[model samples]
Target: MKAFIVAVVAAIGLAVAAMYALTSNQRFAYQAFATTGARVSEPGTNLVGEKWTGDPNTNDKSESAHGKATGEPSHPKRS
Candidate 1:
């Protein structure tokens, strides 16, 4: 009887896990599994044609900034 009960419990847990995996919500396991979504020029290798320069739209010279380069001041004009 005890063995049968344990088996039933295990089956239920497995079913719940399967349902979770099928959910649309992105989870840690799914994100970590994919290193990069960008297409690769060659299979089994990660090589880029050119290094990323800076955003053309932004005045900031840095490669990455907090927000988009809208060419506008973030703060409002002071009185």
Candidate 2:
């Protein structure tokens, strides 16, 4: 019983560590893209671009206007 409990606890700890690693990796990738002024998006027929600035619509006029008013660029546009 004690061994079973220890194994369960170890499994849970491993799962949490894996989740944290995955999340951190994703965050790092986003940060790298933001720093480089690049975008990442899903491949599709529309082929829409996604800037790494944490916002989704940087090129749309309405979104841009709103972002400017809020003093935050909706997405960092590649210069």
Which candidate gets the maximum lDDT versus the true structure? 2
lDDT of each: 0.42, 0.47
Give per-candidate clash totals. Answer: 0, 0
What is candidate 1's lDDT per residue for 26-51, written digit by digit as tens? Answer: 43332335345422222111122112
How would you encode candidate 2's per-residue C-alpha lDDT over 1-79 as one tens digit per residue?
Answer: 9999999999999999999999665543333443334433221111342333444354343454321222233443499
TM accuracy, model 1: 0.30
Instruction: Extract clashing residue pairs from model 1.
Output: none
Check candidate 2 and list the clashing pairs: none
Candidate 1 runs further than 4 Å off:
25-79
